[model samples]
Target: MATNQEEVKLFGVVGSAFVHGVQIALKLKGIEYEFVEEDLANKSDLLLKFNPVYKKVPVFVHNEKPISESNVILEYIDETWKQNPILPSDPYQKALVRFWSKFIQDKIVASFSKAVRAFNDEKEREKNIAEASEALKILENELKEKFFGGEEIGCVDIAAVFVAFTIPLIQEVAGFEFFTAGKFPKLYKWSKEFLNHSIVKEIVPAREPTLVYFKARYELLVSASK
Candidate 1:
């Protein structure tokens, strides 16, 4: 990776797991780049031009060619840098990694988000709790080693970073016991190690402000439900 010739920049918002994934990848690869924070409330012209289809945050621009979607950006970074390889070299293992990564996005995130918002509705809360628990159990079984991709924090770990980062906040706001160690031991242990990772610790936002924001959002959702 030639640093001097190429210009690298990241467009993202704070408190977004998707953006965090890209940032973490950049740090893992030891890639020096500029970060442009986008205000989602007021969509930026540059963000729109780069990601017109989704009109969303987390657009990774490498030499003025922007890559949309966090997973795509992760793949690009791994392929381009070739230093701290995130994905596995073996074809079958790589496929499995992608499967688990997509599973985190598709199966886990929806239920987790629902569980957070269901704080106001007892029945809905329980339903999402059960769903989330089941999903987490599957992940627990998959993480036979230290991380999703063995001992090293790899691409699958990057995909599931939200679980390590935001789940505790949701647990606090919902007053739920979903992520208890007594329940999902492996998943809980993985989360602790994931958060404790040197590079990962650097990217997490301060808990106080994150709590303030999530608390307000929880109250708003509760009120709207009523």
Candidate 2:
């Protein structure tokens, strides 16, 4: 439980998967924190002050200290709250988890974003899709249990919030299909299981509005690409 002396708050925008990861971590640790929804078009001075380097949302402020980046915040939350441990206690297992989490962040998420952004160019989109699918295949081969964290949802699972939720929504809006069940059964199944988890169910943004928002962005991106 969080003490009254320790103040916690999250600065973020709605419909952001990165921000959602932080929310899930805090909830998993049963820490009560204030959520400050930032208007990215006109970012708040507080958010700017907290995360000047990146100037991004999902700036986690704890005890008047701010931690930027979603993955970093998740690690901080796990280290700060002893209960409901997300990272493994063993050093080797912990390193494996961190390795996979970084893989998801760097390869999986980046490849998917490239695919979405390459929507207007068929050849480019196909190339990006191939790269994205290849990344998913690596994760598919790595899964031997219910999650990347084995039996429980761990840091790697939380790190893959974009994979379970956001990427599917992006696929829908972008009219693409790279992460299908037939293509990557293990990863696809893991996504379904991850999304169905109780905490994930609560934290995931409502599908309808999220879709609407992404659809609008998709249109704008396509138009710009043209």
TM-score of candidate 2 to 2 decimals: 0.96
* Model 2 CA deviation exceeding 4 Å by range: none
TM-scores, in order shown?
0.93, 0.96
Task: After superposing candidate 1 on the true structure, give the runs of residues whose Cα lies further than 4 Å from its correct spot.
Answer: 224-226
lDDT (Cα, tens digit) per residue for candidate 1, span 126-211? 88778878888998898888988788899999998888888888688768777878998888889999888999889978888988
Q: What is each predicted model's overall lDDT from 0 to 1? A: 0.86, 0.88
* Weakest lDDT window of 10 consecutive positions for candidate 1: 112-121
Give the clashing residue pairs of candidate 2, or none. Answer: none
